[model samples]
Target: MTILLSQEIDRTSYEPAYAQLVNILQASMATGVFKPGAQLPSEAQLCEHYKVSPMTVRRVINILLDRGLVTTAQGRGTFVKGVDIGEAVFHLSGLKEQIESTDRAQVQLLEARIVEAPERVARKLELSPVDWTIFVRRLLLQDGTPVSYHRAYLIYDPRRPIVEGELEVTSLEGLIHGNGQTDLQSGCLSIEAVTLKEEEAAILSMGQGDPAFLIDHTFYDFQDRPVSWGWFIWRADRLKLSATIGNRPPQDQQSAMKDSRRWTGEDHE
Candidate 1:
């Protein structure tokens, strides 16, 4: 299939052609320009379009394969991998708590203050543009190494001791549900891939423009009103997320498997 690339590698840049191509293809995949199971352009086509050597294209493809983003079939070419959203369900949890189980982890509260809400944060937290919110910044360290950073904005309530509550695990209750709090009621989470900026990289002890995972979460009350919004920036090398797809008893699981086989005609033999 013929593919039209919207961007090309800058040969004059210090970065290699392979790396640039990899990022381009990754962006294409992220934007759904190249849908799942769609065949990537042939090696010859990419080589001609991007003016890169076959080795460069091969290296980029290999990198994609390592990331589990694409697969190459012998003689058939490469195709994007289809993702099943139902297969992975990440729970709402703190980055510090998530890494503390297996590693010696610590969280440092860098800053906590009431600040004018950014337009994006105001929109997310469902607050007016003129409203002020509590901004909290934290750094998570695993085994004494910085691994993740967090930035949160909470709805300001004068009755709630937000700064102190923001420091403790149970404090999320106060921030989310307002003054008298017990536990988390409900929330939402989103994950995306991002590159570190100068400030973020410096804080995380990573190189500027390095890849990382951005986790955005919003907490809501029983009334379904948005209470808080925040995001965590985690080093890509330090985190891995997985989930079990289904919950079934042993007998039920076996029966389901057999039914699937019967439907697929595998039970005929």
Candidate 2:
């Protein structure tokens, strides 16, 4: 079980050895020492070398597994995952255009229909308990490979005509903007790591329990009226987001300040 690794675990530090092992392996991967498809040291090897337990080894492997950093074969061993572009931080805007600009990227409408608003959707839009809304589901692709699955529920006004064709060809974000009445003012967007469920995995062409990003967006209008929002699930290995960390433009800053004032007054948006 004993094997030599030049960079041994720091037993003195408070951080668990398993976590440290993850960092070491990540550094190794970044430095090309652990190339894609290369098998990592076995559990016993890690245990003996790090003076740790089998449980600790398992934790390390599981962390790597969930992050899509490594994969395993039934009786074989764990191998590093190969990824083209992975991991990103993004602002609320420009998400759709970013995906399309990638090579041969396209959007495919999976389902679009008018349906009664679920409680959660109603609460987000601040609608009555029993209300109607448009449900839109779509898939994003790169070179025909599924990258993300997006589902959205919007405030549906039955009086307005539904344009199916335009909805299919345009990004949901763009479509919402085109309405003109629904001005997306400001809200929250959060991204979290998630284990894909059976249905989500099937749609993303990945295995159940595979790693993915769950992005939740909640936005209001200029008048602070909650209108529509989207929840997007993205494959960890295929997608990355980027953000600019700077002050908003002057006009946007003014708008944001106004939004903040409006938030304290009424729970409209």
Candidate 3:
């Protein structure tokens, strides 16, 4: 099939041709320019259109394969994956918790193993730069449509075999809590706006540079030690987010005022 590419890779920049091509293709797929089951342009066509080598095209194709964006058949060319949606998901709990509560949500584990985390993630999980961490990657789907991508990092317990003990653990927090080592009691989570990268765009079937939510969450054990640090990226249009805050009791408010007055050296009597 003859596919039209809207953007060209800047060869002068340090970014490689394949990476740029991946980004371009991801944007097109996310925007529904190419629907699922639609055949991607042949390698030779991509090479000609992008003015890059066939090897570059293949490399980019491999990335899309790894990301579960497109599948290649033995005799046929690669085609986009299907993304079907139903009623959108709303949020009151964490992603895993939300998935657990929802009846129709299904989890597809992409990768799960022990791996070394990056600098910021390492710091967040209170692990040394070189320490190995348990990494869990999965996709949450609702009605056969991928809704979010979740990556969680946990401090690997050496004595306990986490994989064996928590083989059926559904949630990241549950994975830690069920280990019989420490209970994850609470989480501190912050949500911010983020632009979907090429890889994320491909995984979630959204356009590249699309608006999404970057949820950074840290789970704390009963002792208040950070047990895990997780990141979740949800497609902007795939979910609606809401929160509920209750009013503080009058006694709690009075106590807060008294504490403030005591700190400020005001008359407490």
Best by lDDT: 1
Model 3, 1-269: lDDT tens digits are 56577789899989887888988887788777877888899888999988998888999999888766788986789898864333233354344444654567777889988888789878897777898778888887877888889888777767634433333343643542344553456678788999999999899988999989887878776667676788889877654453322211124433432333224465666
Decreasing lDDT order of the candidates = 1, 3, 2
Mind giving the per-residue lDDT tens digits that candidate 2 earns over 1-269? 23356788898899878889877777777677778878888888888877889998889889878766788887888888776343333544435554636456777889988889988888888888578877889998777888889988776765533333324323654543344433455666788999999999999899999988898877665667666767889887765444422211224533433333223565665
Candidate 1, residue 173: the lDDT equals 24
Off by over 4 Å in 1: 1-103, 159-183, 243-269
Candidate 1 TM-score to native: 0.51
lDDT of 1 by residue, 1-269 (tens): 67798898899999988989998988888788888888999888999999998998999999888766788998999998876565466543445355545547666789988888899998998878888788889887778888889888887766645424434432432333344653346778889999999999999999999989998888765567777888889998776553433221124423433333215456658
What are the TM-scores, per candidate, against the unseen true structure? 0.51, 0.48, 0.48
Candidate 2 Cα RMSD after full superposition onto the native fold (Å):
19.9
Ranking 1 against 2 by TM-score, winner: 1
Q: Give the Cα lDDT of each candidate.
A: 0.75, 0.70, 0.72
